[model samples]
Target: MEYIQTVLFQVPASRLEQASETGGLLAELDGHRAYLKQQPGFRDLRLTRSINNEGNVLIVVETRWADDESLVRYETAEPNVAGIIRKHEDLLVRDSLQVLDMEALRTEASFARLESAEAARSRLVLPLIVPLGVLAFALLAIYGLSRIYLELDKGSAVGLATGVAIGILLIAVYVANNPRMPAWQVGGIFVVVIAALAGGTIWALVQEDEGEATGEPTASASPGASPAGSPAAGGGELALTLGDNFFELAGQKSPTLSVAAGKEATVSLTNTGIAPHNMHVADAGGQYPEAFCNPGGATPCSDPNLIKAGGTATIKINLGAGTYDFRCDFHPLEMTGTLEVQ
Candidate 1:
């Protein structure tokens, strides 16, 4: 079903090096790759060189064709391998050239097996890997952007992000439209993007560290005391504030709040950071029942809705004396606290 033609020759190691420098033997073979691609039924071409036992360099040029007729037609054409060898005879070892024509023995069953393997890989591996890769890239982009936004003022952060985004989009558009863009250009684009992301992230971290050294409080710092004029702990009212990946109450991280048992306590939640947050308190025995909570739910008491950045929500709780675990449903692990009703 397929055909192969191979031409082999040997040249002295020194001659090969000279040919390389003068674009003689190797360059001619490379030129053939493009030329043969224009011929009918040409499938592939490969050129390889190795050192022979006689200390000469053995060069092999192998070409695959769709059928025997195609190989025969190519051999009869002008400027074929035989002609090229004759042109470069002075550089090659005397009486060290051979040409062979062979039939490919690949069976139909082997082709079927290969196709099946490829199909399986497409069905199983690609779907999982592609999504995971996309998710990882998205998370990295988000982290870089968030860091930059945190370290810079709003105008500077917005301008930087917009400029970078526009540049990337333009490059993507150019590459997509050009289809045959040079490899070096693609590599340079990737290098620029990677460097920008890394540089922004590092710059943001350094700025944050300097701010900390200057005793500037971070977003995650405790709220310390209740806001002035806010309801007191004995007044059946409490307030909790949410920061980046953290929950604060009465000047503590994941702190415990006491409420009078069997009395309705109005707890207000405020999101002070740039991420959505909500509080969910588990029922007595610290159990979240399925009927009352959705999958991955923490319920029995929860904000009616998530509080967006700089937004607020109020929830009323009237539970018997018990300590209940509470957390942000969206960020359960990083943001958590306890409510003690006694």
Candidate 2:
């Protein structure tokens, strides 16, 4: 939810030397707007003036904030805001300044315009209920898929399941924001994700069949073996697999790697996942506190090389006999593994 603030002040005509002063005030206000715009979470700032029959001019300033925390930070520490207040203190009529803080509950135009209270209530309630319902259903789907798929590790399975849940929750929020959106369209988001998952599974199976027919080795089937279609592993070549927020070695997700002491190991990474990823190697024991390439005790971690969706990177490093950990900088918990130096 976003936060909004409105400030209104009345300036007497006597305070102005001429009509040109209004323009000068506005110009100064523009400088203030520019300063606020550079601040984080500053969405919009608007300044307008209204004249009453008594010839007193009312200046209204409306501001939109990304969240209350951003608003609070600005209010507490922003010298620019304070400057504006101080600059205007003499220009405004005595006791004319008013500030109001508010939270945006519902943003739909129809919700704001509805003549009936019950109708607006229904609109507000449905969005909250729909997302919760969709989340529950997504959890059930995840449970069913976990039961049917035997090879998925608990962590990987839960990650995938919760992803669907998050998608459903997002869809719910979208539909709620669009009160008039068609029901069928709202339902299609879930169907599309489910269909995509099924299609991906079938495609993976087909790829496995093709590999078998062509006599190429598969990663999952050959733990500790070199990656398929990779460079020769004569001296220091090893393979790392990247999937949707997960890492794999030889073909197994989060599998450990063994390297000889006082030697160099080149790691070739292939990303089959649908997102960009990168890997960083770090010493596990904190004694080294650096990235290891081969069998070295302490070494600087190789710079992270970006692997776009369906991309690969090969990096070589040297480490002494010690324990190390390699993980995706983007997803440490779901994509991490150990390296054993013998």
Candidate 3:
């Protein structure tokens, strides 16, 4: 009747293997400490044995909520006190909770050193480190070349190329030292190299797109303009994308989520599988009824529809006081989970 509370005791990735054994560190430490005894709004919590785990076996528990927004915070906030939020969310097994507490009075940096250090180290290693090493060798070679060859002018073509190479190496070192440097931007270097090969393709695409948008013939299209895909959403919105055979959680998926006794919230479905996939929702009870579907199902039923690869779908349903099932009809055992509505 009150706040929905969830407790999860997770292990740092490094100690994962050690935490899986019985009475391991995960059970004794992370799991046990979730409770600051006598803490307000404390409810039932549990510690369980890890199963089918290739990683640490964490202790997980949950409770119910009266306010939808509170549920959101309860799900996200406090758990972040340590790194538990980031560590557990991906590997955690779904443990739904229904709160029975009431009168809940709720109130409301940066150790990015790893990132900076990585940038520092990567600079030292990848660009700076590598180029400096190369430059040292190149400088030695230049000296040797000067000693052995006839024309040893520093302004020669070889000398110019050597200077350019050294300059690029120095810039790489600078980038390695700068955390703001985007290593990926170096990919543009290849774009320049391929410019000749891809010039026509790029130009044709631009002209064709412009022609389509302006309803004109491609042969006589204007100089430069093209209809391009809209830029992606930046903040608080998730854009599911496919790479190879999987999906990436691009941005915030559920920006505004709602839950109530009779109100339904939509589930955003994406197929990240190699094969075509679909999504379906059912009650925690064995109702076997499906809800929300893609280009497949019409309504709630026993079998959910199949969504194709790189596809997406949606579902909305009202839930009352009980636990509900949320799962991919195909990857049932692995992709299945519960949606608790107290």
Candidate 4:
């Protein structure tokens, strides 16, 4: 089903001197540019501006939906970006009064910017051979020691010593590899990751054998279904579904489109495309359609929760024929097309 995400991004209006544009302010706008969705659930979203306008600083969006169930799922489902929204919410002049609806596309850069493990590696442009080699070596040391300890079947002391050894080895490897970084900080993260992975493996080995003898497997109770969330059997609160992009309309930016002025329309945002994409609409009340003022997570377009990745959303509207900008937040510069509200 198609769903609509009617987002209202509210920015603040302050004096130019005190409210000068800075990293913090720009970051808030940037967050809006790429904030598609997160893991937990939808939290509050607020953007601040020191020098923006008053009433028009709001962004009104109408995300299309495929059906009622899809829309319901998105509103109640979890979102992963709550912390990011909170972290940057205070930096800008948060009017929470005005709304700014800006459309963001699931640009290649947008997904790349997410800093996923693969993305981080690609952006760094380093000789990965060395790092990979070091990682392999570290794994060997930890595993070898861990195996030895297990065979001996010693008490926690051996486990503790192995942990400490892994910690020191990780530090040595990091320092020898990237001395430029702070010795202490890098060492700490390196040791934690190595210890966790290695330690977890050892524990799992023991547990699996034990489970086999008991004749009761616990993998069925894995956290795969809900992601520690509620049941996915119900419709989506904020979910990613098929047919989100380029499905019915090949070469189209999004599968779902919004007809303006409150038309009872359904926009199914199926994410056929590999990258994530979100829709935004700005109401042009007989103007050039340049002003966008709105706040995120203030009220519901239909229900309040947001649409999820690869998920469909809906937007209902009845707009008179005029000009409106329906676009995505990812491709802010060129990923925009004209919407004539008939």
- The candidate maximizing lDDT is 1
lDDT of each: 0.73, 0.64, 0.43, 0.42
lDDT of 2: 0.64
When sorted by TM-score, best at the front, the candidate numbers are 1, 2, 4, 3
Residue by residue across 107-215, what tens digits does model 1's lDDT show? 5656998999999989999899879967876777889878877666434767987997898789879988999999899778767877788788898778665654442
If both were scored by TM-score, which would come out higher, candidate 2 or candidate 4? Answer: 2
Which residue pairs clash within candidate 2?
293-317, 293-318, 294-317, 294-318, 294-319, 295-319, 295-320, 296-319, 296-320, 297-320
**What's model 2's lDDT at 236?**
57
- Measured over all alpha carbons after superposition, the RMSD of each candidate to the real structure, in angstroms, is 20.1, 28.0, 42.3, 46.2
lDDT order of candidates, top first:
1, 2, 3, 4
Q: What lDDT is reached at residue 29 by model 4?
A: 40
Estimate the lDDT of model 3.
0.43
Q: TM-scores across all candidates?
A: 0.33, 0.31, 0.23, 0.27
Backbone clashes in model 1 = 0
* Off by more than 4 A, model 4: 1-188, 194-262, 285-309
